[model samples]
Structure formats: C-alpha cells, structure tokens
Target: MDDPRDPRRDATSETAGNDDFGNEGLTSSDTLELEFREALNLANWTSGNRLQELGERLEREVELAARHESEMAPRVLDILRRNLASAEGASVESGVFQLKPEIVLNALRNVLFNGLVEASDGTRVTVATLPVTVVQIGVCLTSYSGDGDGGSIGHRLFRHDIMRRNSAAEQDVIDFLGRRRRRGMDTSAYGDDDQPMGISDMLCRALMIYGERAMLLERSERPWRLGHGGPMPHELIVGSGRKEMAFASLEMLRKLLLDHKRFIFVPSEISDQTVVTIANSLQPLQYAVLRDTTDIIENYVQGSSYERPHYKRSGLYQAVRSFQVDAGSKVLLCVYRASAIAPGRVFYAHEDHVHEAAQIVIADAALQESRGFPNLIDIADRTCRGMFEPGGLSAQVHATLARSGSPFRFLEERRTRP
Candidate 1:
C-alpha cells in the first residue's frame, strides 16, 4: 500500500549514473554490498507493483554483480539459486513456503540448513544451503521485522518478499495433495485448479483487505488500528511452562502490542471446539467471539502467490477471513486456532512459567521492545546489518551496552567497565 518513488525511476537513475563509471568503478566489497542491499531492497519493495517486471528488476540486481563485483558472483547467484530451490521445496509440504531474512541468512551459512524446522505432521527437514532470495512472495510471506525505521509492520510487510501467487508451488502442492487423496485423506479442494488457502494466502488476502479497509476508513488513516481475535489452546493461552507450543505470530504480537495488544490474528491451525474453549476462558476477561466475517472478505481478495489459480472455498483463507477483533476488550485481544479440520480440544496455563522454547515473532513497532518477553525472539537482523558488515547500524544497542567509558579500568579485563 506504500507508494514511494517508482522502482523503474530508481533503476533508471542508477543506470544513468553508472554509464560513466563503466565496469571498473564497482570493485570494492563496500560498493557490491551496497548495491546488493539495494537490490534486496528493490526485491522486497516490488509488492503492489507489476510483479513480473519487478521480478526481472530483482534478477537484474543479481546481475549487477558483474562490472567489478566479480568476487561476489557466487554469493549473488547463490541467493537466486536458493530462492528457486526453496520455492520447489515449499510446494511439497504446505501449499506455500515463507521465510524471514534471518532464516535465509542462516540457511546460507549452515552445513546445509539443518537445525530449525519442525512441521505439523511431525516431519522435520532442514533447507540445506539455499539462496538468499527464497520465496518472498506476497505480504504474509514476509518476516517478523522489516527494513524500515523501528521495524514497523508496514516496513516489514513492504520490504518482505510476498509474492502474489506461485504457479509452480501450487502445482507442487496439488501433486502432493493428489497423492494424499489417493491415500484417502479427503483432499477435496484439489478438485479444482487451486484453493486460495494457507497461512500465507489468507494473510495476503487480509492485508489487501486492510488496504481496501484503509481507504474506506471514515475515522483514522491508520489501518493497523483494528483490534484482533482468534482461538488459542490452554497451554499457550494460559501456559504449560514445560512443553513448547506451536503458534504463528500470536504470542509475539501479544507482547509487542503494548497498545495494539487488544488484537490478534488467527489462522486455521486450531480447532473450532478449542476456539469455543478459548472463548469461554475469556469470559473472565470479558471477551466474546464475533460471528465470522470470512464470507464477506472472500469476495474481495484472491490467492497472492504469483501465478496460482484461485478457488472460492479455501479453508485457511476462510479462517483468517472469519477473524474478528473484539473492539470492547479491556487491554488484550486473543488469536487462537479453530478447526473444523479436527474435532478436539486442550487447555492449561502459567503466566509466570514459559516453555523455554525460542520463538521468533515478526512484528511492527519496536522489535527492540520484545527483548526479554518469554517465548519470543525479536529478529532485528536487518537493523543490525551494519554491525556485522561495517554497513548496518553503527550504534546498535548491544554494541553500546558492550562498550565502556567508565573512569576505572579493570586489571584483568584491561578496559573500563561498561
């Protein structure tokens, strides 16, 4: 929804400025990194624009490695190569795949991306060395924090790669689901070309809806103001203090929402009975569930991956579309899962105790504010890019904390204490 200068214009200006320098001027790693960063910027910024052409522009950025960035050639290609491979991989499990920049960076450095992921069906797989340019397709496909100031939601959404739809991945999904159907798993949606359902798909639709909603706002210009709602299991809602819970951005949003704390976004990961359980549990907090509005929003947006076909009855999209925020909540909104998919429930808690599991939540506002909140890891990766490369923020909070200017120097430490 952000309309800054056209990327075409930026590229034109850069190209024009480059005509005189020829191939020799771009040699320094500093220059290569800056340009690569710009390309990365453009890649994320391509949302809401002509996606295909913008994609070419992104590839052109990788191509910019020539001239004098020859040393960075492998790394640049690795970024692009990994992107395609991951796209293919995402198709096999979930109909979509999304990753944050930190995930990609780690994948690049790993001995083949092995330690992080664990799927819903108990499947585990590591990405194994991939590109820096994985599937950034569409708004919901983005990471927790973005490249803008303070890592606000708008900045994250804008700079994250959220492709509208991916035909290839969709095909991969259909093929996988077909195999499932053959095994009698009730893969009904595959009866059509594609279903616009999935965490990423619905999230994209929600954002587009918000954009439309933003325009219709008779009150504030702020689209992020709407409250949120959804179901949650007792362990996560209350706490287990022992077992790690599975959630998308729910808890992170809770801790980060200092003001917007009253809202939550729910996906199709939980059951309907559980939703009712969560709703009942919220009675003490004076919260109530609103009838779903999924049908209303469904008419407005479609699947966001680049080339995937869209169908009418995607379950995941409906879950998000049905989400309603309690405008009357005192200070917090809850987002839990509701499943017509599964017919069951579970609940329990510990506000003082946490699962000791590390979760990374992508959020707006200051990711910095989430420093010590349990169950959440604030990934302000891009924000600290310079510290690692002599290019990120020169004065990161951690750096300042580690430096010392005290008058006394410790004999063993050999420096003034911070």
Candidate 2:
C-alpha cells in the first residue's frame, strides 16, 4: 500500500536485497545517516522528525555495539524457553515448590523493564509507554538493518520459518504483532479518528522515534545487559527522579507488580507460543487454561463487575486471555488480561475497569525478607501516574539498604530437562 498509514508489508527495496528503504547500500559515514534521516522525514508522521534527530545521536551506538545484529529475535525467545521450562530446572511436585531463584528473577526482570517500549502519537507526538516503545523501535530497526547480504533478522522475527522448523521458539514477530497488540478501546480516545494505528503501525512509529532514542540511550548513559535476550543495554539509573520514589530493587519491584492473583503488564516481548514450547520442555509444569475458574485460588476479588465477571471461558472467538499453571512450590502465574489499575490519572478509580489487555506474564514471589517495605510501596504510588518508565533500576535499586540482598535458594527443584 502506497498510503503512509499502511505498514508497507510489501514495500520491498527498489534495489534487490536492500531493507533500510535503500540506505542499506549507502557507505558507512555521515552520508548514510543523512540519507536515512531524509527517508524517515518522508515517513509523513510527526514522530519521523524526532527520529531524524535521534539518528544523529545514535551513530556512536551503532559503531560501538555492532556485535548485536540480525539474530535478535532468537535471543529473546531462547531466554523465555529456558526460564519457563519446567523439565529443565524447576518442578512443582509432591506439593513442594523449588527453583533456582536467580533464574526466575532474571526472567521476570528482563521481561518487566527491557521488553516494554514507548510510542509518541503520530497525531499529537506525545510519548506513550516510554521504555516499551523504545524497545519495539530498536527491534524493528535492527530487523531492517540486516546482514551485509540481503538477509535480516526480520525474516526470522516477522516470518514463520522458525515455527515451520518445529523448533523450541514457538512464535514469530508477525504472530506476536497480531495476537499481542493493544488496541484502542471505544471508551477512550482514537474512537472516531480516520485512521487509528494498529499495533504494528504504532510499532512502526516507535521504530521511528524511540528506536533512535534507545540507540542514543545505549551509547551515552552506558546501560548494562540483563542478557542477550534484552532489547537495549540499561544503566542502574537514567532519569532525574529522587531515589526515594523508585522501587528499592528488581526484587522488590517484582513483588509489588505481582502482588495480586490477576495482573496485566505488557507482555510485549514473550509470545504465548514460546511459553508452550518451554512448557513442553518441562516435566512438571502443566500448561492449561481456566475453563470456568474452578481451579483459581480466588475469584475476581477486585475490579468492576463489568470487566471482573465471575465467569470467564476461552473460546474460538472469545477465550481466556491467559495460560496458567501451579509451577509447584506455591508459585502460580497467569499470563492474563484483567481489569487493572488506571494509569496517568494519579488517582485510584474507586471503580475498576479491564480496558484492553493481552497476555503480559507477571512474576510472582512470596518472600519473607523485604527491608524497605515502606519504600517499595513507592512504585505504585498514585501520585505519579503519568511518569514514564516509572522508577527505573538506577533510581529504584540504589546502593542503600533499600537494595535487596542476593536471594539464597529458598528451595531448589532438582530436575534436569529430560
């Protein structure tokens, strides 16, 4: 489709084997950046201009970390597979819960901060979902970057080749883009706009603006890596917020977000297919859905009755938004969509609503030690609802007593993948 609003899924490069619009052939120099900058300017969105500015700053990041290239998608999926696999490490058996706590911690942390992205509206150019948008932008740009030849990670990310192989990583980008998208609800804005961006279009916009920002953040701030699966390298603290207002550590942040039986974070990174593949590799964890909520520990205890109906059933057209299992040892997680707290309002709406949700897998941990329990509550403070990437690692995980000690193995599930 020639329309700028269209995703240009069929927009092949004029020259064979070129993906960066045509800048793939450009020599590595100021010339290449300028060429790409002009191409993004023609993207016909306000975010495009911001992307052009970002291109100037991102050159250094590309030069320094050229090590990360086309194989980006696999790294993300591999982490998911290993972390969630029941047979490999953790097993819920004989009613005793055991696991390598570090593995679970890493998986949860990686998904929470790294997987999210931010997107600026094409119409108003306002940034939305800060870290998540940048992550998506970086992933898309990396896909378009390709290898020296024509092949790119996009082939692996957006295409079905990986699934056809019947491999461990069960899903691809296109499937994720289709199934995991967060659409505009009728109750909110974008109700009557001539064109409201789909999940991919918003991703494309993020590809323009936040992609550049992520690259710049990588070089200037010097963020470290959780692992190869993460979207961008992150530093301890990157913003100008008070340390008192952030999460004490990754450990505490995990506890706060997953405090409930049902939650909805952004599962922007891991696909359900990957969860199934990991489930297959595991011996103990059973991947099953709630047919009628009989197995749940509790019913929808909170939220408005409209969204928190007593009955939920997965269907051909309508289905359970999550797949959950008791991973033994009292660890129960549901990658679910439910009426959650509102954002940017700065006030807890007495009424609850389950607006639009996909599966954002949350990390659940019931721990005995939390030194800064008073401080850890800052993460969900209703005062700063609009704050972007609210309370990042640097601010949240400071060097003070707020930081949690390395968790000892509460219980180790002694099982290897068969």
Candidate 3:
C-alpha cells in the first residue's frame, strides 16, 4: 500500500506540451476566434428557416407544460383519489386493512442514520512513500419515543471502527462476509474480481457492506424500548436511496418484510420512469375540472415485466420484489404530494399502512416548510453528522500515526494541503 500519489507524475504531465499529444500546429488566437465565428455562421446558415419552426415548436411545448401544471394535474388527482378509495375497500374486504396508531406515541422511535467518511472512497492514505489505506466510519441509530411531557425521550446507539485493506481487519471482514453468504445472504455485490482493484474501489465496496452490518446491529439494541419484547423495531423509517435502506442482502430484505412486518421506506425522490408515467397517464386530464390540493396515488406499480431485465439487476427491485413476495397485500407503493409546493414522494411500505405513512411524512414535512422534507429523517441525519464530525476523526487518526513513530514527511501530499 505505497503512496499512490507521485509528485514526479504531476511534474512530467506539467512539462509535456500540446505537441506531445499529437495536436496539429497551433493557430493564432485571432485566427481561432475567426474560425469559431465562421463555424457558427455555417451552422446558422444550415438551419435556414428551420430555426423559426423550432421556435414555434418550443412555444407549443411551453403551452403544453402550462396546461399540464394548471389543468391536468388536478384532474389526475381526482382519478387517483377514486382509485385510492377502491383500494382501501378491497383491503378491508380482504382482511388486510390495518388502522394507523391512534396515539402514535411510539411511531418515531426507530430511525436509520448513515455513517460519514472524510477521505475519498472512505480510505485515507498515510505516509509519504510507504503508505497504507485505512477506513474510518462512524454510524448512529436513534430511537425517539414520546415522554410523559410534551417533549420526547430519545436514546442513540453509536459505533466506530477502522480497518486497513489486506490486513487482519480486512480478513475479518472477508470472513464475516463469507459467514453471511453461508447463511443464504447475497454477497455478490461485495465480491472481488480477477483484475487488480485500487484501494479506493476495494474500500468503497467493503465500507458499504461493513457499514450496513453495523447499522443493522445498532438498530437491534434494547428490546423493551422497541415495544412488544422485540429486539428490532416494529416500524423502521429510512431515507430514500439505494444506499440508505435498499443496499441490504436479499435474505435480509425478505426477513425484514416477513419478520418485522412494518419496514416503512419512504423515498423522497421519485424515478424518471414514474415521472413519465404520471405525465402520460394524466395527459387527458387537461380537459377536466381543476382543483388545488394535495393527493395520493395508491398501489403505483413502478416498473413493468417488459423492463424486468434492466430493473431486476437493481437492489431496489430486489427489495420491492421481496416485499411483494413475503409481505403480500401488506405491501403498498403510495405516490403522494405534500402540496403543490413540492413534487410527489413514493412510500415503499411493507405493512399495508400506505396512507398512514403518507400522513406521517406530510405532517413531519409541514413542520419544516422551508425544505418540505421529512423532519425525522433530517434530524436523524443531522444528529449522525454532528456526532461523527469528520475533522475530529481524521485528527485522531493522524495523532495515532504520529505516536507510532510514523514520519510525518512520509504522509501523502494531499493530506498536508490547507
């Protein structure tokens, strides 16, 4: 793990001129500007009258967009509202409908917060010539249950670990991954290839796998605090992204759907395909009556069987598939807008509590009208960052290196930069 950075390489690159890269004789600046203007004129001449036609087309597009926002959106909401009612009735008749908690005293008790890393790829190279790659991670899990007073009572579980690649620590991770694989968990995402990998690339994958394991263990603390004598939470609220809650092993996802039964994954960001579907499905609504209000579209199927090949490879698809298979009618995908102020969000719920999840998100978002994002997720994220300030962690690592008689001059040049 020698220092990958070499000052000689930068010096060589800086000394090399344009001619070294096979460039033709450089033209004068005036000639270059004249050539650019001539090319622009040629392009304009080639376009001819088509530019006017393009302008007219753009005008039509603007008109269509205006119609979509002012007219189509409201009508689409009405149809979605009707469909939601139908779904609710079907769920009730099927004996799967469950009401939201009346008090919601323990609803916000569970939250998953991501770890923070300062260096590129979660790995920092120490020493000047003979460098080693080390990864530092700090993760936290919070449970904020209601107290007797108006305020809330909360507790945080914290863990920190550092590992150097190809060392005993790395071997421990490899063995841990192997054990998880033996237990029917999918570790293919964290697999190694025959080709040589950089320290950053290797550490990136290792960090994700290790960080997820750390998060899972942290979330399983204290049974009494999680309600009903269970180590895991009944309802776990996580942010929307592949790395957030969707990066778990396939077996772990199935266990979450089947065992926990209430893993509420609210993705604040919607997909492009979903956006296109929403736009096309509501195109005809331009002729209908318009209203200004928030609405929900229930049971929105994300991708189709036609695109299974592309989507099946994604972790999100695996998570959604697990919910569909193990959670059955308990699963729901609700697309709802808090208001016209923001776009719609998807709630990938696994307990037939789509409306309730939407309500909680909306209510929490209302409290932070500035961003209109979920306050619970935001607060948890902020808490994690605050607890694990990257500067402090980096300083601690450097201090330990100094104490071990590692020459400060051997440190990477980038680490010494202001």
Best by lDDT: 3
lDDT of 2 by residue, 1-418 (tens): 0111122111221222223333455566867677678788756443754777677658966754333322232343344433434433232211111123343344335532343311111011222231122111122111111121111111001211112323434455564444224433222112223233222333333233332223223321212111111111011111011121111221222231223212222212333364433222221111111122212212211241213332222121111112112211223222221112211000000001111111112122111122101111122222122222223422332322133442222212432224
lDDT per residue (tens digit) for residues 81-161 in model 3: 345445432343111111123212122333211111011011122221333334444444443333211111122221112
Residue 118 error for model 1, in Å?
32
Model 1, stretches more than 4 Å misplaced? 1-133, 140-256, 262-269, 272-274, 277-418
Clashes of 2: 23
lDDT for 136 (candidate 2): 19
Q: What is the C-alpha lDDT of each candidate?
A: 0.26, 0.24, 0.37
Query: What's the CA RMSD of model 1 in angstroms?
Result: 26.6
**Candidate 2: residue 110 lDDT (0-100):** 51
* Clashes by residue pair, model 3: 127-410, 127-411, 128-410, 128-411
TM-score of each: 0.16, 0.17, 0.46
> Which candidate do you rate higher for lDDT, 1 or 2?
1
Candidate 3 — what's its lDDT?
A: 0.37
